[model samples]
Target: MLKHPKNAVMVLARCFSDLDRRLLLLILIPPLSLIVFFSLSSLSPVRSFILGRTILHPQQAVMLNSTDSQQSDVVFAPSSWKDELDRSRIAVCLVGGARRFELTGPSIVEKILLEYPNSDLFLNSPMDSNAFKFSLLNSAPRLAAVRIFRPKPMPESELQLRVLTAHNSPNGIQGLLQYFNLVEGCLTLIQQYQKQNNFTYDWIVRTRVDGYWNAPLDPKFFVPGKYLVPPGTNYGGLNDRLGIGDLNTSTVALSRLSLLPQLDAAGFHQLNSEASFKAQLTTRKVTPVLKRLPFCIVTDRKYDFPPVRFGVPVAAISSPGPLSGVKCRPCKPVCQGPCVGDVMEGLNKGWGWTDWANGTLELCNAHGDFDEGWEKMFDKVAGKKLSSERKRVWKLTVEKCIANFNKMRNRTGIWDTPPVDEICKTGITSGPK
Candidate 1:
């Protein structure tokens, strides 16, 4: 109880010394040292550290702090082009007959339409027995316009005869004219919709109904200035199977028929579909950018099996690919690896050659028709829901088909085609008139 003042002072001094030693130990530890160092640094230096700069030695910290404080302020960068496109108006212009639409349509719905649910769909197809398949679009998210018309023979002008060739086109020059009309016709419909609504679409995706998409359309394909098309199957020109571009470039690319006079004037002769497409872009001064895309044109056309040089190599539907809109069908792959390399070597580089390197392509012996139970094969590859759609279409009754068509017609902003009864009945049993 009778403690001396000197003894109390000595106890206090010893306590202060112990606290200092503990504080030094804490600062010397790696984790706490970092925190202490940052705490002591100026705000600008701390901000630089957080913005991916390495912390300097304590000796250099003061120098960095002084330099960073003198520099301009940092600013955040904007979002990517994909984010811009997600908000922008996009028109998915699907052209061609619904020949294999049952196999292909669901993929379009799942990959493109659902992937970009805000994009409007414009369906321009010539009515055929397979036209009933177009009814599947009732499941699509944004159906904008539908034009299923009777195939009328387009009058082949002298210029068309000169500028276009019947070489590989099954229907000859007339067929080319009809296809051109269909594509350009979709552009016209898009323009009409824009005029009516007082707003223009920022992008247009021109693709075929027969395309079996194995993957979603990558947003990187949506480049602003240049038109994007597939790299191979140039056929002495560019791959015309699919195209993606802005409004201005698409107008030039899609005006397939209207630009015939321009092609004729440019002295382009005997040009096939792809060549004509290339001519159009060249004439219009639109630079085309080629990227390998994930879909292929599902075809019934027979090509030489074990394709020779310059012969078409049909891809197996199951091949892992950005197949770039090449001809494909479901079948057991006949060729792979070295076999693919040898077959691809024979094919003309400017014509049918696709990048088969690193096992990117698998070949189908397409000389025969699609293998039996191809639906099962497709289902296995496309997943449960898409396969179910295929079965539904195959087993579709006339009544249900008509009902689906009605729903699609109701959703469509522009409906131009035969009556629903006729479209539905044509594909199903041909009953008494």
Candidate 2:
């Protein structure tokens, strides 16, 4: 009459099995549980990497993390420039040879002062027998500071040897090293000046002392986020010829040698000046914008105008310029007619060479012997008002320099650990800007 023992046992086991199944679900889905718990525990590391990358490269990462519960408050945006007429606090650092400074210095100074009177001037030229006298630059709109140092040549070192050897001793490689040394020294000088004065620069304008300015340095070319270099002379790449940038940009661009390793790895071994420049810009992801500047390197070397032979002069200062600054002069071209036409035809791509066929500029040559008429012509072109202004500025700069020179006595800001040899001295006396 009592139910079979087996049936009673089976009924009890079924009820237990149902209870166990409910308890298992309450404990959590194993896979999902592991995910939530670990994510919460390791929250800090994941958040940090995401935030760091965001700060470094914000442009690429924006919409990807929208749904994440963690919020990124930082926003990265590109800079915008309205090209206002207001003066820019620019610093022109001239630290190279002085041979052509006299011919070109006045024009450059006058143009900048007239166009952007708010700019400041700084010259870091090391002492050389022929360095441009500061008297020329004295007329700058606002005198910031000038320190003329006797550049200590690159110390003989392994790096110098390696750099000299690296690119098969390519043409202009030595010149490259010389330029690198000059720039690096001046950058050091800039840092020192900033520390001493407790001031920083918004932009640094670098050019040879002898670069003649034929017209206004149009500020419209200053793009917000990219470095600008003159066009035309883009020899195999970016012309390392002249450069302008803010402090943030310059810190990376100034040291040419520091970039050699990367350049070599990128297979950029035999680049000419222009090509080297292009590689440097593109490789480092430094965006470069080409713009026409109303200036050209005052050169003294002479070559055939419509060069047919390798040594023939294909490109010249004259060519009806306003050549969109690729590398032609806007001045009355010395080589008119056939030479201009030939060079124009020979030009390659958006690179080297320019066309003056439209005729808005004139002829001038840095390499040609100076004519007395040329000086008078410049004086006339500059007008009486600018001449007087330049003269006055020159006087003030000379006086300031003399005052500074006397304050520092014989040191004259030229630091020589053991002191400069008397025989090697260029004897730059301060009385000018």
Highest lDDT against the true fold, candidate: 1
User: Candidate 1, which segments miss by more than 4 Å at Cα?
Assistant: 1-80, 430-433
Please, what are the lDDT tens digits per residue for candidate 2 over residues 132-231? 3444553465555555565544554444444344342233456667667677656666677678778886777766665666677655444444676666
lDDT of 1: 0.84
How many steric overlaps are in each model, in order? 1, 24
lDDT tens per residue, model 1, 194-222: 99889999999999999999998867677
Which residue pairs in candidate 1 have backbone atoms (N, alpha carbon, C) closer than 3 angstroms, thus clashing?
309-346
Worst 10 residues of 2 by lDDT: 416-425
